[model samples]
Each structure stands twice: as structure tokens, then as C-alpha cells.
Target: MDLTRTKALPIRHGKPKVLKMLLALALLLPAGFGIPAQTSYAAGISKPFPQQVDYPGMIKPSHVTQNAMNKSVSDYYDYWKATYLKHDLSSLPGGYYVKGDITGDPEGFKALGSSEGQGYGMIITVLMAGHDPNAQNIYNGLFKTARAYKSSGNPHLMGWVVADSPKAQGHFGSATDGDLDIAYSLILAHQQWGSDGAVNYLDEARTMINDGIKVSYVTTNNRLNLGDWDAKDALNTRPSDWMLSHFRAFYEVTGDAGWIQVIDNLYSVYDQFTAAYSPTTGLVSDFVVGNPPKPAPEWYLDEFKETNQYYYNASRFPLRVVMDYAFYGDPRGKAAADKITGWIKTKANGSPANIKNGYNLKGTAIGDYATAVFVAPFISAGTADSANQAWINAGWDWMKNKREDYFSDTYNLLNLLFITGNWWVPEGQAEQPIINLALNKPAVSSSIEGSGFEADKAFDGNLMSRWASNEGSDPEWIYVDLGSVQSISGVTLKWEAAYAKQYKIQVSTDSSGTPVQWTDVNSTTDGNGGVDEIDFSPHNARYVRMLGSERGTPYGYSLYEFEVYGTSSP
Candidate 1:
């Protein structure tokens, strides 16, 4: 695959030109000549939706019950799956394409689907394994379809657009965002169901990443070019394509430290752009061009007049940048996320409903009306800071039941998964099975704030409920009984606004023993309030307690959950 190949005409986001000559030639070729056949595989669900993954350093909406969040994702996915996901035997036998809407289509270009939509469909299906029984079959079909419409420049990369015909002529070049998502989704598929199946998803992912993506899309400077047809343009790049989490996964799979360079380069670019262009808001433009990258000129890409503003393309910046923080605990990611959330919190006056559709780099709203495409990503960004808890809870309420077009709806569903903690890293990496032994266990606290703030609420496995100690009290504690002696390796404390400045994890072999001998397993003096996972050498105990010595706030020490993890005593 030649990385420097250029075409006479550049392809816009979803609109592409129809090559009549290629269509004529494609009709003469035999059916499925280049496309691979779909083979049966023993693909089973390993990590399913509502995995309720505990992202190491991320926060979720604490104002709503966990069940409500899970239900919101399922409900939106059902509608999105029905409306956009389409199967067509016109090209590959088992081919599926996500149906696209005709919004903002150029005059000559008819709306079908793009590589972007295919990538979104693939990712959503793979993550939705347990919830959607037919996810595997649909995912296989989507893979086949993406493969059938390979890019003319590089077969490993899917073409950017699939126009009216399902034949090869319908596909035009490639887009960077779609290719990135498609490659990342394959890694996810390999992790969800092992690569022993017919697809060998891991192999395909490596090919796409190494041969296709690295060659055609990634430039010599380590910045992502617009698409395969960009001819390695170094100056101009799409901001939304700066997917830090995806790049991290790429580096993990390929061991290419170049991906790290790419990550560092993009972070630098983000900081530079935010400092220079949006000092206060930290908002970036849709397309950034040149060294010391600045916003693109109006009508620069021939896409739209607002190409330089934070329009549809750049609206996804928050979700893309924040995932690195949520998954990998990157401080840079958190810093970037906090900027967006912080600015938006003030802009919306702390209301999710006031979030506009688009904005300029200086934080002026380009559009007045609210849309899910813009709101959803902001909600995802809000998860980075505990200060935005109320903001994100309001965002979830505003976005959960709303309906929009294909693009907006799909983005909404994806962001919803991220916001609710349903989206997770693939299994081959740091993914681990999470089990909370203290869930629904008998718990007792020294004191409570009121009638609703009971000790059992902390052990009920609900984020919306918590156990609160008496106001301004020190030496307050809460403990949970495991019913029998068990080995405890780690504990997670999801703290509320009234968090403990200092706390100790103490355990006893017997809850009813005389004096109840308690031994300290872990102690922390600088305990910050978000989500803390304290790990230690395994200890056997029937009773575990959180003893607070100091309070972080004026109120009591409140905890949303007290989770214990370990194997049973043997």
C-alpha cells in the first residue's frame, strides 16, 4: 500500500463521486471475487453490555440508579439498531450496512452509508453482545460488507462512501475516522470472542493497523491525515480523528511506539490549539491546518462554511479525548476533559438542556438549537470531573429519551454507553472480571444523616443511594458482614460529596467474637473523593469496615458503594 497516492478529486466526509468506468469493470468481474466468504465461528460472548465496568479513574452519573442507566442504553440501542442497521445481499451475501440519512449531501451525491457509519455499527454491535443475541451474526455481516468495499488505494482500509450501487464503484477512497474505528472494533471483536473463530479478528486488525492505517492514514509526522486519499498531507488534520484511547489500543496491539509519538503529538496539538485559539473554553475547530495548528479557513475543505468552527465533526472531540482518561488514567486526558466540562458547565449555566449544537473556538454558539450530537459528547466529557456530577446527571436525563437523525442518534447511543460505563476496553488487554462480594451484604454504620441514609444503602449495589455518617463527626465508621469468612484482596470506595480525608480498611476474622479483633489492611491519609480502588495482600475476614478519621467536607463521610473483591476462603 502506497501511503503517498493522491487522487484527482478529494472526497468529502460522506459524499463521494461515482466512477462510471469502475462500475462498468466491476460488473464484469465474478461475484465475490475479491471479498472473502463469511465462515461460521464459535464466537461466544465473553464481555457483554451492562458489564458495569469499573473504569479505573472515571466517574458516572451518581444521581440516577444503575438500572436506569442500563435501561436507557438498551432502549436507545433498540431504536438505533432498528432504524439504521440494514442488510443487503446485493454486494456480499452476508453484507450489512448502516443506513444513512440525506442531511447535508452535495447535489450530485446520493445518500447511502459511509465507512464512518459502518464503523459505528460494528462497534455498537460488538459491545452489545449479551444484550443483543444476534450481535455476532450482525457483526460478521458488517465485517464482510466493510471488506467487500475496500479502498481503491489500500485494500485493508474500507472506502469512505458507499453510494447507490452496492458494487465496487460505489465505494470512494477512505476516511480516517471510519478506518480508525473499524480497526479498533476488530480488536474488540477478537477480545470479546477469541480469534480461534473463522474470522481471526486479531489478524485482520493487525493487518488493518499495520498495513492499511499506518501506511495510508498516519503521516510521517505521526498525525492522522484526513483519509487514504489525502496523499499524506502533513499540514491539515481532523480534530475528532485524534482518538487517544484508540491510539493507545493500537500501540498495545502492535507494540509500535510510534503510536505513542502520535498520542504525544496530538496532546501537544490540543494544548497548543486550546491555549492559542480557545484559551478560556478549550474548544477546537472542526479542521486544523498548518504548523502551530490553527483553525481552518471557512469553506476550506469544500464541505461546509462552518468547517473552521466547532461544528458536527469537532463535536465528538470531548468523547474521543476523554476516553483515554477513563480507560488508561491519563492525566493529560483528564486535564483536557476538565477544560471542556468546566467551560460547558459555565456556558450552559449548569443545565444540560442549554447546550447548543455547535460553537466557535472562542465559545460562541454557532447554532442555537440543542442537538444530541453535541450534547452527548459533552456528557461524556463531564464524567472526568466529580464537580460535573449534577451536570452529567442532567445530561443523561435530557439525552436518554430523545430521538434524532441517523448521525445524531448513533452518536447519542455511543456516548450513552460511555457515560453510563457500559463501554469497556477489549479483553486481551487490562480487562478483568469484576465481582463485588460486599454487594447486598448486611451492613451497619455508626450513625446516619437521616431516615434515607442507611448503612445498607452503601452495600445495595446502587450508585444513587449511599450511607452517610452524622454531620461533622470524626471517628465514624461503616462495616459490612460477608456472612462467612472470605479472602478479600481489594476494596473500592465510591465516595459522595462528603468524602473522607483519611480512612482505614480494617477487617476481623469473626464479627461476633469477643472484642472483635480488627486488623488494618490498608490505610490512606490523602483520600480524594472520586473513585478509589485500594488493593492489598489478600486477607481472610468475615467483617470489613471503613473507619474514617477525618472528613473532607463540612458534612458527613458518605459513600455510594463499598465494594469488596476476592475469592472465597479455601
Candidate 2:
């Protein structure tokens, strides 16, 4: 299996690019209640209507600002537009395109599979098609790769991996989550690009929905199985695999009543969790069992004795639930979204910076750092709850300069796109641009004394290069000044061997004076090399600095790059 065999899921929040073909400004009522008429842009295509949250109180004081969110979204898209799309997505020898995230491998990525890459590639490509000129071609390439790895048992279901050989790295089998997203992305692609040219988007979506999804969906209990191999029994469903919004979309497209039942059953699972494990908090677990699945009471997950806790897999519930609200405004969806917002606000003291990694179903922290992936989805939760505005701001702040990897990067950008209002709704939908709304924010360090170790290199918007401290120095610092007092979430430090082993990330409002007033936002005595993305409570400051006290090796503290990012209510 690949290193990324178990992936975090996307739920609660939302996807899509706008098209102008469906019912525009018409009420879409399900059974009884009528929702607000979904309005389309001048194009008159009926995509998802844009939604707004009524943040209570004065939205001004919150450090999480609109401009900050915009800046975060813009900076991230620009950084990833090239890396994930242009560079990382390369053509394979088999004439299929693979998006490879694994780097610096001794075996040259031979055993690495590319199914996850194929799925995400298609999703991102379709989303970026409006801005990217070569998006369609790239999507076609990725689709080819997906087809190349077709599962033998179920032809429609793709083999979970695509390695050097057909049998290598489980390339012979399939996984449920990737295929679901890939099919859903194809549906969005149909709406975004239309069934035209050489490729018929609508027809292809139908193929995936019928041939792939229909064939694999476990019919007896109205739930999805793990994959083709799973017996689709009571004890088999992965909670992370349940994406309610995608199920709804599936119902809409296929007119299959079973899909709706699947969604209803999923919500039932949510209800069961509230009653059994976490009543008020409503936290979901990573895995579930039985029909109308409930969390495993006495199960083990890695280090967690209670496998039902919200860990890597279940962190996506917020993202998934919020999407249902963002698009359909389902009351159940709103309730689910509120569970996370209320829980985080109450548990983390109303700030995402305080939230820790993983938690028991009863709302107990599993003693881990607040990761970018965990925080990103909550931003979607904030979209449904205006009271979560500040928290949403804090979440976006955490995404700033978030290191791009297979999992966190994917979730971060999706969360960024949604929270920042850059993600679109298909058919007559409008989207804000993903760009730095914050003007020229110059980056400077305490000192620069070398050819390659320039202070500005860290913030040059380049992935490579850095600011190395003067050798023999115990205390070295680098900082970024945002021209004005802005809401900041945290900073990302990419390090080499001579990195910070002990450091203090601090901020200051006044850069001048005898002793510049600085406040420590976050500190680390055990700093890991690679991408060290750290978050803090929302801070309003003009200056952000990384003060290193000790180095990882004999050499001075060196940073491949240092980045400051966050959002504000503005």
C-alpha cells in the first residue's frame, strides 16, 4: 500500500465552477419547505447560489478579517497553481498523467501509486479550469491515468494505485473514497465545462455514477462499502468514506432514491453518535459499524484506544457537513455544522489556535498539535455559523503558507477556496479571485551577511532558497512586516539541516523604539525539519518574527523559507 492509503475525508462543507444552464432564481423545495431561490449570475446558468453568513455583533473587532482571508486564499492558490498543477502533475511513461507528491525517494518512486493523485488532479483541474488555460487537457491526462488503473473485479472502479507495474503497490485493487471524489468531480466537470468537444462530460459522469458508483454501492443497507473487496456487511463501512453532500448530488443526477436514503442513514449515524458517545459536542469518529453506523465503543486506532475519536479520517466531517449547508442549506447539515463550530468554540476557547490534534468522541484532546488539516475544515463550519467568524478567520490564518503535501495541502486549499469565497458553485455561480488582497508586505530579517542566505529570500515567493543565520550566533531572527496592523494566524518555516531546534515565533505592532515591543505567539523546543507549519491565536500586529535560540546541528539556525499568513474580519 502507498504511504497515503488512508486519506482524510471531506464532508460538511463544499465544490464547483459555474455554468448557465439549469433553473435560475427558482425555488428548489424538497418534499415541503422551499429554500431561497438559487440566483444565477447574468449568464443565467443554475449552479449553486452564493450563500452568506450573518456574523453576529460587530464583525470589525475580530482579528480574522475578510482581507486576511482573501490574502490567504490568493497567496495559497498562486503558490499551488504552479506546484500542483504545472509542475507536480507530470506525464507518465504510459501516456497517462500522474500527480506525484512523494519526493526525495531512494527507489525513484517505482512502488508509488498514483490513484489518489489522479482523483485530486481531476478535481483540482476542473476547479481551476476557469483560470487555467490548459486545465481541460490536464484533466484529460489525469482521467487517462485513472482508467489505466481500472480494478479487475470492478472495471468501473479504478485500481486504488498506479505503480510502475500493474501488480505493484496494490494497483490491482480499488479504494472507496478516491473513486467517490473522482466521480463527483466528474459531475462538477460536466457542469463546469459541459458535455462537449471530444469528451462528453455528462455521459462520462453517468458512466461513473452508474457503472462505478452504482455497481459498488452496497444496496441491502443503503450505505457504501470500503471497496470492491469489502463484503458490504454491517461491520465494514468507514465513516470517513461517507460524504453526505456527494450522496445528495448523486441522487440529483441519477434520480436514485437509494442515494437519498444513504444520506439520511448517514445523518442517522450522526444522531446515534450524539446519543451514544458525544451528545452535545456531536463529534464523529474515524470508523463506524452496523447499519445506520455508530462509532466503535471499544476499538483501537494507532495510539487511540477509542477508535471512535475524531482523528485524521473523521476530521473531514466539518468540511463535508458545511458543504451541504453551503449548497443546499439543509437543516440537518446546518445542525451538523453547528456541532463542530459550537464544540470547537467552547472546547478550544473560541480560537482554533487552542484546538489540539484528534479528540475523543466525548470531546477530549488526544494530545497533538493543532494541524492545518484539522483547522481548514472548521473554516467551512464557520461559513454556516456567523458566531464562528473569528474562528473562521483563525482557521484561514492557519492556512497561510501551509506546506503543500498530499493530504494537508489538498484539504488546506479546498478549505481556503471555500472560506475565502474563491471556490465556485456550478451554473451561473460567481467566485472571488484567489489573490493577495493585502498590498506589498515586505519581508526582512535581523541581518543578512552572505550570498545565498539573503534575508528577503525566504519571502521572495519562491519555494526554494532561505535566510541562514550568521554562523556561531546563538540568537538569530527573521521577520515579515505587513505594512499595517493585520490579523495573523501563524507562520510556516521550511528548514534545512541547520534549522531551529529551539525557537520563539513572535509578533510586534511597533517596529521602532528603544526595545521593540514583541509578544511571543508560539514557541518550539522540539522543531522538526521539512515543513514546520505552526499556528497561534489570531494576533493583530504589523511585524511577525522567528527568533531562534538554538540550532539543530553545529551550524547556525537556517531556514529554507519563512512565511507569515492569516485572516481578519475586514
Candidate 3:
């Protein structure tokens, strides 16, 4: 059966009774008789939602309150969960699946969900543990459903689609994207809760990664094939499947260096395609083919006409690429991300609403309307540089509350998690800790945006809250008192969209001296917005201030968190 053409079979009227009888008989059997007992590992949740992790080099939209950001995710998940999550099939009781949208189905197949959607559901539920009380249960049900639809080509992989009719066998082939995410989510589950329970998540992840993915999906050239069935066609590859961060995680868990080769190979392919076809925009086609890797021709796989353009599949490129830079700090990833975001910022005239759905390699908009599927990835890409801070902020505002179709909504939630700093690295792969000396310290500013955004908010160690100076102002400043003169080595400024283009880190030993002598310990004329980490020679000062000379944006300087690092003076 054609993967795309296959649809869910209609349910028969009398089948419910038969299914109920079957379920009743199965329940009466021994412990290991039928489907394994579904375990709810609620106690295993370690890192829950609202993690607000301070990713080392990534930036977030600083204008909105953190509560608002968290609400956006929670509200959307509630809607998405209610609408798409389904468990009606009695054959797979306690097994859930995401229901695919069927608005324009001519044949009325009553579509069940795809393996891709199943993968997405698993990842979303695991990440949203704290916010949703039934997250673990939902996640386990999704996992059971995925396992039931095992791929014919590879037993370790799930089939591409699920059908409703008991007689109809679903498409027992695997899509690479589904397998990749499913395996990654298992690792996250292990980290979130441990492998000691009924489900050994880590062990399952290892089997999937080593036996399922490495054996079937990964080509000999270290490039990812589109699916398990597409392994014979080694040259044809999907740009969105170049998930570098996932590959890194796979390597981390399996201790396989081959995944590293996969990462390097795909990065080279990305470089080759961009340099040859899209040097200016850094946009990739949905499908890329050949040794040098050119965009696949129209009707290449009979998927769609826009395979050669940056359509639905390639729309995910930015989110995938930017995560590598955000998590691992890969310069190549940053360089690739900058090319796409910098062009989009100019193309959209700094408005996220103006972003189109599809684009040609040369940066021309192919699709006229704006949708979250296209816009959300750009928001993720915006985090790659501080220069795109305003663009990132605008993108978040545009995408936050909008409800679209399943594909759009799911991608939007995933991107929102990354944008709001809720997405975290797995347990063992986390970055080193940084101590902020100025956290919760006494602070004062030259001006404030309003009553709530006061001077002290900048020192509260919260990413959601910020302190803003008066609009369109010059010579604004925010200072933190260390209580007494203390040795300080550096400061990190998590700036809002309204950042300082020119600023100085000035320190004074005496907080209430007659002359109020202040010396510039560090200064910069070229300050870009994101997270600025400035280090200077260790100096003992009771007061430290960021003196802004010129604003980066039209508004005044603002900071989410103005962090100081050092030890107390002797």
C-alpha cells in the first residue's frame, strides 16, 4: 500500500461487541498472556515543565512575562490533547494514538494518526509532565500503540500509519522522522523518570537506536534515509531529517561514534546545498538528491510539487539546525541558522505575520499566506543570534495563542518549548552550572517601563521578568549593590528586545561616596541583543552598573536578568 494513499478503514457496527468479548477474555488470562501491563511512572518525573533552563548561549523573547509564556504552552497543550489524542479502538485498549485531521478526505477513510504524529505525541507528553497530571499515562499509551504497529521492514520500527478496521493491516513501513523522535523520547523518559520500573526506557532506547535506527534508517554513507523502505535509494534524503541534536543524543546514549559521522555528513550536505543553490537564503528543498546533493526534481517521489522548494518538510529545517547551536554550540549550525533568519528578517520587514508558508531557494516567497508551521521554525532560528532579538520577540507574539491544524499546532508547541527555555538537555548531557552572584541582590535603575517592571526585577534571576528603561531614552542605567565591596570577574546580561547598542560596565568601590567615583571596567560599542557575557579583570566594587549610551532598538534598554559572577572580598 502507498504510504500517503493509505487511509483508516471504517469501523463495523457489530465489531464493538466482538472487541469487548476479546478484551474481556484477554483480561481473564495470566499476567504475561496478552499485552504487557501498562505502567504509570508518575514518580519518575524529575525535570518537569517550566524548567526555565538557562541554556548557555541561547536567547528567548524577553518582552513577555514568564507566566504568560508558560500559560501559552499549557493552554495549547490542553486544547491539543483534548482534540487530537484518541483511544477509541477496543482492540488496543489502554493504547492511545493521535487522530489525524480529515477535513478534505474525498474517500472518507476516517484517518487514524501517522507514526510521525505518534512520535510527536510521545515527546510532547514527556516534556509536559508537571503541567499535565496524566502525562505519564498518556505517554505510556502512545508508546504501546507505537509498538503494536511495528514496521514489516524493521521489527524495531513502528509502521507509518494506523488503520481502524481490525481486518486492515496498516502501512507496515517506517518513516525516519517518526523513528528518530520516538527513540529520542524514550531517552527523555529514562531521564525524566529512571528505567527501574516496568518499562526500562534506557534499554528500549538503546535497542531502538542501535538495532532499529542504525540498522535500517542510517545509510552506509552516514546520511539518513527517508524511511526504512527508502534505504535502497541511498542518494535521496530529506533535509528535515538532518536532526543534528538528536544524533548527538543518540551518540551520547549508545556510545556510538557512527552517529557523529552522520552529523558531520549531513552538515557537509547542508553546506553543499546552500553554497550551490541557496547561498543567500540558506533555504533547503524538502528533498535533496545526488552526490553533491542538489534539490530533488519536481514529482521526484510523487509526494508533492514543492519538493524542490522550502515547503512543509523543509520548514522544520531551522528548528532542527538551531537546536544544535543552542545545545552544543556548533559554529556550523550557527552559521547556517544566521543565513536563514537574517534573510527572513529582511524579507518579512521584521514582522513575523508577513512570513510566507513556502519559499524558493533564492529567497522568493512561493506561498503567500502566513502559517505557524513556517513561522515557528524561524522563531527557533531567531535564538541563534542576538541581532534577531526583535524578530524573535515579534515571532513569539504572533504565534503564541493561534490555533491551527495538527501539523501546525504540534510544531508550534515544540518550538514554543524551545523558545521559552522549557526544553532541556537529557540528564547526563547537561551543561556545567554557573553561579550568579547578583541573583536576588538589591538593584536600582535609572527608569522603569512601569510599576511591575522595576529595577530589582533584573536581578531576580528570572527569565520571564525584566527591567526596562524609559522609552526612546538615552543615558539610562541599572546598578546592583553587592552589599559591600566584593571581587567581581564578569557579568551576564539577558537583554530584552530593547537592548543597548552601546554600554559600559562601570564599577564604584563606594556606594555613597561624595564624588560617587565610577570607573569603566568593561565597555562595548557593538552590543547585539541576546545573552551578553562580558568578563573583565577581577575588581572589588560595592556597586556595578550597566550604563547605556545608545539603544539597540527604538525603545530603551531592558534586561531580563543582569547576572554578576565573583566572590566576596576579604
Candidate 4:
């Protein structure tokens, strides 16, 4: 999650890449036009081209400027290259590799589950195969691990063991998120890289997913169980949704019709499970299970039987996992993605004005809220451009108005960057100019002015500032003045302590004058009570402001440091 700005490499957009391949047919004599036509680079390749290439030609191009629009895809690929390439698997236990981000302590981090490390490893590996060199390395490492973990008579490659053993943190079971994640990752890498080694991992991941279907999925009800019904009866929707993403990736890599069938079946299961969402208040149930998939019990926590205040922190948990799966182009997958995005909009509209501080679900705005909203537009833009635009505006508005008190950790800043880069408009659109943040400083402070506050009162103005929540509360506001009107490309905000809730940012021709227009930007509430960030491209404005709205404590007007990020239109 560590984010550092780096120069971008120049590569043609996706359209040009496909065009370069297709136009290989028509050789131009250039008899009509005075200028010579550029030669096609993909003349020799066979029909039915690959969707994306890691490096069509070797040696990164010169003059490619690195910015939010181009860097999103590049940076994701770079993470795998830098981390996994340098770390060798021979020294690691069982030849299994985590490639970093594994704390190894199961109880310390909430996101860390039984197979979390291996699961994350799998996803990373699959995503890596989208590029080159890195794909080869990932394929090799995964195969080595598979061979070591292979059991007798296990031709289908069904099981993967937990990274944390009984001696380490008390093992949960043989298979968990880690197995699914790794298995899926390996399959994707195999398909993309086409390395013989990848077959073992892909076969194993496919086997494990199907087995989970047989043992854990409730056929009559069409819901996914936590693991086994005897030990854990709870049917957590997040993991099931994540599995759908794995299936979608498998389909994209293999182009196998059967994989699509698997994805469709999973979506059918998801359709029945997602019925748990309450109509009265858009909050999804914390736990949902039933043969008929009945509503929550009366004492459960809401009018529907679940609690009204389900943990606010993991609100994006279900949506993000589901959307990642849907991004690969499944109809039902897209539905799941839409469901989560729609739910988030409702939460933003109905959220309590005053939130408690610190990292509790109800305490502060977690970073994922912004991400859930932000990703909606990106996922839908190719298919539903208008709906995507609306989602982008709403997501950016929510983040701009209230981000200070919600983010308490720096790790999530990377997520913010993803949101910004994904929706970025190519330069030269009439839009609000985003104030490029000074990366060297990392943080700046501000406080809201109260009725009795003096000019020099250290931002001690409003008592109800949104940035003053307790989980990581420390307030301040600071911003940048974009020299001119430019399409905003991206943004990232950091906090010294407590995360922010919501804020009001104004853009004007005059930095010190009244805002000509205002846009609402809200940050995601951190589920783990840490620093969070939001990102987007708003093609209008010159000045931006972060106005804190809620604090964890009764103390009013919590304010804190602010950040502005974007690229110039020219």
C-alpha cells in the first residue's frame, strides 16, 4: 500500500493497441496524403488478439509523462515486479511465498483471516500475469509451492494449507481465503503467461472452489457459509462475492465457456443471498443465513432482524469484493457491483450527521466508503457511461465534503489513488483544476473557525468540525491553488491521528474570496480505525477546501490537515 509518485511511461491507450494489430492488413502506399503512413507493428501475429499486452515492445518509451491517468495501470503492475521478484521462495517455508503485506499474526489485523496471506498472494499473482517478466516469475514461484504442498492421489490439486500453523497462531483449517486467492491467482497467471508450471496451481484453485461449492454452499438456499455449518453457521457474504471475482478472472484468462457457467451459477447464489439487504434503511445485515433466506430476527438489530448500526467500517467490504469480481464482465457480477454501489449511495444520503471518533464501525468514516463509490463509475463507465458519470460526481462530492476525520492510516492512501486514476479524463477537458499536493510535506493542518474564535486561534473556530473524531482525531485544513482550470486527475489525504467524516470544499477564481461553486467530497470511514483517503477527477474549479463535518466526541467542528492532488489539463 506504500505510495510514491514516479514518472509515467508512454504507451498508446488500449484502443490504439488493438487498432495497431487490426490495421496490419491494409498496407498504405501513401499515394494520396503527402505524409507517409506509420507502419503496423503487429503484422505477423495470428487472428484473435490478446486484450492487453505487458510490453508490446521492450524498453519503456521516452516522453511518456507519468500522471494519474496513465499511472493507475502501471503502478499496480509495478508492485508485483518490485516485491515478488526480489523475494526468493527457496528460503521461505514450504516454498510458499507471501511477497509482503502478511503480518503473520491472525488476531492483530481484522482483515487477516485463516488463508488471508495465501489468498492475497493468489490475487496478486493473477493480476501480475496481465504484464510480462513479472508474470513468468509469479508462475514459477506458484508452481514450486504447489509441488511442495501436493498430497498423494491429489491429481486435481484440491487443497492448500494455512500459512499460520498451530504452532504459530493456532491454525483455522486446511483451506481458507488464502487457498482460494492463491488458487485463483495461479490459474490466472497460467492462462495469461501460458507457462506449463501454472497448470498445477490453476487446477488446484479450480478444484478447491468447486469443492467449496459442494460442501459449503447451501444449495436449497443458495448461500455461502463461512466454512462448515457445524463449526461456523454464519453465511458471510464477502468471501462468496470475492470467489465470484476469482471465477470471472478465470473466464477472462482461459476464455473457457465452462468458467463462465461457474460464474453464472455463483451469481445465482449471490442473487438469493443479497436479498438480505433491508429496504427501510439501506444498510446490509452484518450476518445473514436461512434456507428460505428469511429476514433478520426481531431482536437481530433492525426492523428486519439485523442491527440498524451494522459495523460502518466494513460497509465496502462486501461491495469491493463483489465489484472486483464483476469488473471482468459477468452480467450477474455487474449486478452485484451495482448493488453495492447503490447501497453506498444510500448510506451517504442517510448517514448520521455526528459520528463517534476512533475506528469502530459507527465511530468514523472509513476509507473504503469513498473507494466503493469511486469504483462504481469506473466499473460502469465502459457500459453505462451516463450512470458512471453520475456515480463519479456523487462519489467525489461525498469525499470532498467529509474526508478529514474518517481516514486514520496511510496504508489506504493507495486505494484513494486507484479511485482517482481509474476515472481520470484525458487532459484538455474544461473542468475544475485540482491543487496538486506537495508530496514532500506529506501532511498539513487546519481547524474550523468558531463564533468566538480569533484569526490567530489555531483553527479553533467550529466545535462540530468533521475532522475531530477520536479514533485518530487531530484537526487541520490545508489546500493548494491549481494555477488554472484543469481536469482533476487524482487525490490523497493523510491524518496524524483520528480519521475524518465528511467535508465541504469550494472552488473559486479567488482563493481568498467566497467560493464560486462548492462540491461535496467525503472520505471512506476506516473499518480498522486508520488513515484513509479519497480520489476523483472533477473537470471544473480553481480553489479546493476541506471542511470537517463530524467528530467522534461531542466536541464540535473537528478539523484537521488536508491534501489536494490532480494533474494540469494541458
Top-lDDT candidate index: 1
Which window of ten consecutive residues has the lowest lDDT sum in model 3?
18-27
- lDDT by residue (1-570, candidate 2, tens digit) is 000012332221110011001211111322322223444332312232222222221122157565565555556656665565432323344334443443112133352434555666677666655345566677776776677668755778776655555443333556677788788777777776666666776667667877777777554566676667665454546666777767666655653434545666567767766678788787788777665456765433232344566776677778777776665556677887787778778888877777776788888888466666677776677678667667766665666777835566766777766664444443311122122212235767666647767777766533224567777677888877777777887676766556778999888888462228889999899985545767788988787788888877766766645666666632
- TM per prediction: 0.68, 0.61, 0.67, 0.42
* Candidate 4 stretches greater than 4 Å from native: 1-68, 76-96, 99-114, 130-132, 142-176, 198-202, 209-222, 228-242, 248-277, 280-283, 294-336, 346-385, 390-570
Clashing pairs in 3: 44-193
Task: Kindly list the per-residue Cα lDDT of model 3 for residues 49-77, writing each as its tens digit.
Answer: 76766565668888988778989888888
**Top-TM-score candidate index:** 1
Q: How well is each residue in 1-570 modelled by candidate 4, as lDDT tens digits?
A: 000000110000010111100100111111221212223323221111112211111111122322432343445435434543333433344344443332212333232112333444444444433334344455455555543443222322312332323222222223333444555655544444433443554455445545443344323223344333222344333332335555444433332223333344344434554454433322333334454343334323221221222332223234334333223323344454455545444445533221211112222333233332223222222122234444444433333223221111111222223233221111111123334342223222253233422222212211111233222333434444555555553443333223345544444455544344556544443222222345554645555555454443334332222334556553
Question: Where is the poorest 10-residue window by lDDT in model 1?
Answer: 20-29
Clashes of 1: 0
Number of clashes in every candidate structure?
0, 29, 1, 80
Q: What are the lDDT figures for the candidates, one per model?
A: 0.78, 0.61, 0.77, 0.34
Q: Which runs of model 1 end up more than 4 angstroms from their true locations?
A: 1-43, 102-109, 164-166, 169-171, 427-570
What's the lDDT of the predicted structure labeled candidate 3?
0.77
